[model samples]
Target: MLQWKEFEAWVCIEGEETVEYDVQTSEDDRTVTCWIASELGKKFSIHWKNKAFLQDVGGSVKVDGNPCGGTISYAWRDLGRTISKSGIADAATLKSFVFSSLEVTDDDDALISSSSSALQDLGLLELTIYPVRINGELESTVFSRLNLSDLKVHERSKKAVTQQIKLAEPQPLEKAPRVLDIERTGPEVVKFCFKYRPIDVLRANGIAPSPSRLKRKASAEPPRALTPDDLEELADLEEAKNLREKLRALEKKLHKRDKKPRIKDEDGDVIDLTQNGARNKRVKVESDRPFISGEVIDLT
Candidate 1:
C-alpha cells in the first residue's frame, strides 16, 4: 500500500492485497512509486482509501498510462473506507482486470516495426488524486484499448517488456456503474505509481529479493545438532575401521614370515635362517653337488 496525506492505494490479486516492493517517496512526498510482482493470466485490481475531510476530493487513475474507467470522488460522508476498481465496464459488461505475459514474434515488418503505446507503458498502474468540485455534467467510463496482441512486438524490439495489464473474460452486468461529474480544483496533490513485472524479471532487476532458495541453500544452513543415534552410528563405524587396520597389520606380518628363506636341520626339522643371530645354525654344503630343499635320496 502507498499513502500520501490522507489517500492510500494498493494493488490486489484475486481480491487479496498483493505484495509491493521498493516503495519510495520523493523528497516532497507528493509522488510515490513502488514495484509489484505480476503473474501471467492472474486477475488483479486497484484499490484505494481516503480520510474524512471537510472538503470533497476526487482523482483519476491510469493503468499503463491510460485512463481506467472509474471515478474517485469522496465527500466527508464517503471517506475512511476502502474501495476497489475490480473490473471495468465494457459496454454494459464487466471485464476482469488481468496480468498477462506479452508475446514477442518475428514480424515480417521487423525492419520497420514502430514502438506502440502498449510497449511504452507496459506494466504500470497509477493513481493521481486532487481536490475537486462537483459539476452538473456526467463523466463517461473510458474502456481500456490495450489489446493483448497490440503488445506483441518484433523480436528485435521486445526490449525488457515481459508483462502488461490485460482484460479477462467479460461477464454480464445487469446494470453498469453510475458516473459522477467531478472536476479537479487544483493540481494533483498526490500520485501513486506501481510498476509491475513478473517475479523473474523483478529478481533480475534486483528490485525484489531472489527466491529464498537462491540465498538459503543447504550449503548455507547452520550445522544441525547430532542425536544419540547419530553419535552411536559414527562410533560403530570408527570401531570397524580400527578392526580392519589391525587385520591388515596381522596379514602383513604373516606375509613377511612366509617370504623369508628357509633351510632344514640334519634332524629333518624345517628351520628359518633369514635373520642372523648367535643361535642361528649354519649348514655346510659342497657347492659342487647339486642340492634341492624338501627332498632326500637313499645311498646304495
Candidate 2:
C-alpha cells in the first residue's frame, strides 16, 4: 500500500508539474532548506481527488554537503502526535543519503481535510536542515519539522501483502571413483589407462585387434632351417601322400563301374569277353583276320 503523505511530498517536489521550488540556505551556505507553498499545492488537487497520492514516487535527492556514515529519522507531528515519519541513511561514500518513507497518513489526515484554497492560507511544510557528525564520520543530517500545528490526521487500516514461493530439493553427494584417462599416441592409435582397473592393455594400435591372435600363433611354432635329410624325407612323404590320393580316386571310379549292368543278349545270357569265353565262340580261321558278319562257324 502506498503512503499518501510520502507520495504527496515526493510528487510535489519532483513531479513534472513541480516546475521549481524555493530554497533557503544558512549564513555559511553549508545547509539548505526547501518547501512548496499551498498555492503551488493547489496544482496537485487533482491528484488528491483521484487518490493519486496512494502511489509510489521515485526520485533522487542531493544534499548540499556530504553526509556522515550514520542514519537519521524524521517525523511530522501534529497535536502532540506523530502524523508521518521518514528515515535517511548515509551511504558508504559519506557524500549522499538514501531516503525512505516510514509512515504516512491516509486520505482522512487533518492536513488534507480542508479544501486546497483554505489549505493555501496555512504554511504547507518546512524543513530544518543541519549536519551531524560523530567519531569524525559524517552522520545523516536530520530534518526537523516546524509549524505543522494546523494539520489534521485521519486513521485507517494498514495494507497487508502476502507472498508464496517454491523451493527445489537439495542434491545428494556422489562417491569417489578410480581415474580413467584417454590420450592419442598417434593419428590412428589411442592410449587409455585406468589406475585401479588394469586397462592399459586395451590401447588401440593402428591395426585391428583380430590379427593379434595370428601373431601369437606364428610365434608359438617358429620356422627353423631344414637339414638335407629332413628335406629329402619331406619330399618322399609328399610323394606318398599324392600316390595315396590317386589310389583313393581310382578305387572310387572302379566302384562306380561295378555298379553298372553287364551287357546281355536278347536271350538274357550275359556276354563274357574273357579268353576262354571268346575261344568257345570263336570262328575257325586260317589266319588272324577280321571275321565277316553272318558267317556260320563251327566250334569244337
Candidate 3:
C-alpha cells in the first residue's frame, strides 16, 4: 500500500503503456504550460493558472488542430495560497511573498504546444482542478467541498472484522485407530489360518493334522544311537577320516596363513590372500604320488 502523502495523480492517455506526465502548480495566477509528443508525430499542450477561491477561469489548449477546454481555481491558507488548473489538475500552494510564473514552453519536434492565459481575474481561494475526457477529448472544471473521509471509515470496519475472525479458535480433527490395539487371540489366529487353507480338500489330499504328523511312527523310527559295529564301520571308512583330517588341517593352515604368510609370489606378483589368492589356490590337480592322488583343494 502506498501512503497518501506520497500519492501523485496519473493519467492514462489513449491506453498507452508508457508516457506519463507530472502535474505542478504555481503559487500565483500565472500561465503554466507543458508539451508532450506521441509516436505518430502528434503533439499536445497543457496549461494551468491559480485563482483566488471557488470561481471560474478559462484557458486555451490545442491538440493537433483540435481545441481543448481549460479552467483554474485556488485555496488560501496561512502559509500561502494554493493555485490549481482543470486541464490536468496540477496544483501548487506557497507563500504569497514568493510567487512567480514565466512563459513556459517545450520544443519536442513531434509535439504541439499552445498558450494558456486567464480570461478574467477572480477572488477565489482553495481550489481543485478537474479535467474530464469526453468522447476522447479533455474538458476542464473546478470543484468545491471534496472529502475522502468515507473511504477511511470503510477501511477501518474491514480491518476490525478481519481481526475478529483471526482471534477465533480452530476446530479439532478426528483420529484413526492404532495398529497395536487390534485383537489377535488364539482362536482368532486359528480361524485366520483356516481361512487361508481349504480344510476339506487338504484332508482328501492325505495331509494329516499338524500335531499327529509331528509325532514319530514306531515302525519307521530311526535308531536312537549307533551300535558298536556301526561305530567301527564309520571308523573304517578311510575317505571320511581323510576328509575330516583334511578339513582340520585346512583350518590350521588358514589360521597360520592369516597370522604370517608370504605377501608376494615367486614372480613378484602381489598375492592378495584375502580374495584372488584363495580362488587361484583352489584349482584341482592330479598328483603323481599315490598318497596325495585325487585330492580336492577346498579354498573356502
Candidate 4:
C-alpha cells in the first residue's frame, strides 16, 4: 500500500534525536557522525566535513561538532536492511536520508559525557507524531505497518507511510577519550583512525568490564511492565497474527467428538478402543479422516 516512489519526491524529514545515537562522534569531540534508520531499517549516515562555528557575544570564535551552526559538504548513503513486512512483497527503496541541520545544546553535551544507560531508552529516542497521512488525507497515527489495513479506505487508494526512527542520548565513554596526536588536517578538523590493541597488551590480571546495565538488571526478577524485548517479540508475532487466525479456522473445520475411538482390523472386525485391554498386540493401522471415509474415530 505504500507509495514510496511518489512520496519520495516530496517527503522530507527534519528531525533530531539525541544519541546514545548514530552520527558517530569521536572521543576528543572533534569529528561527529550522525545516522538515522528508516522504518524499514535502512541506515543513512551524515558526515559533517566541517566543525560548526559559534561566535561569542564578545566576537570570539568557538568550534564545535554541531552541524547546524555551519554549512559544509555532507552526503549520505543507504545501508540496506532486511525488513520483513507481512504484506509488502518487495523491499522499499530508501530514496534519501537528510537532516535539516544539527541542533546542539549544553544538556546534550552533558548527556554525551554521562554513563551509557541512556542508550537503552527507546521512548527517549522515538517521537509519537500525530496527524499521519493516507493518500493526501490526514489519518490516525498508528505505529506498526500491520495496523495500516485497519484504516478505513478503498483498496485502490494509494497508501502513505512514514518512516520511524528513535535516536538515543549519546553518552561519553568512562575512560579518558583517546585522541590521536596527529597534526590537524584543517582548522578544527580531525581525521578518525582505527586503533587496536594486541591481545598481548591486554592486562590478563585486570577484571573484564562489567556486564551491560540491562544484563545486570536482568539478573533480578523482571518488572511487571512489558519490556522492549517483549514488545519486539510481540511485533513479530503480530505480523503472523493472520496466519495464526487461519490455522485456528482450519482446526475448527476438523470434526471432533468426545466418544472413544472405533478401530477396524484387516478382517473387518470392529474393535472398541475404549474396551478393556485394546492395546494388546495392536499393529500399526492405516488412518484416514473421519469425514472423508465416514469412519468416526474418537480421540477423546
| TM-score versus the correct structure, for each prediction | 0.64, 0.17, 0.15, 0.15
Enumerate clash totals for all models, in the order shown.
Answer: 0, 8, 12, 12
Q: What is the C-alpha lDDT profile of model 3 across 1-300, one tens digit per residue?
A: 000121111212233322222223332432222111122211112222332222232222222112222322222221123222222211221111101111222333322212211111100011123322222322212211211111111231221111100001222324321111111111200000000012232334443244467588668667689899988898889778899999999999999877633355555565555665555643343446566568764323
Q: TM-score: which is higher, 3 or 4?
A: 3
lDDT of each: 0.73, 0.28, 0.27, 0.28
Candidate No. with top TM-score: 1
Say which candidate scores most in lDDT: 1
lDDT: which is higher, 1 or 4? Answer: 1
Error of 2 at 292 (Å): 45
> lDDT tens digits, residues 1-300, model 1?
887777788988887787889999995768999998888888987877777554676656677656765556467566887777766675478777788766667866643234666566667887777788877654444444522334555767667767767778889989767666667788778888889888788889888888784565566678999999999999999999999999999999999878866566666666666555514575644355676796674311
TM-score of 3: 0.15
Error of 2 at 300 (Å): 35
Model 2, position 99, has a per-residue lDDT of: 20
Q: Which segments of model 3 are wrong by more than 4 Å?
A: 1-11, 15-29, 35-37, 41-53, 65-300
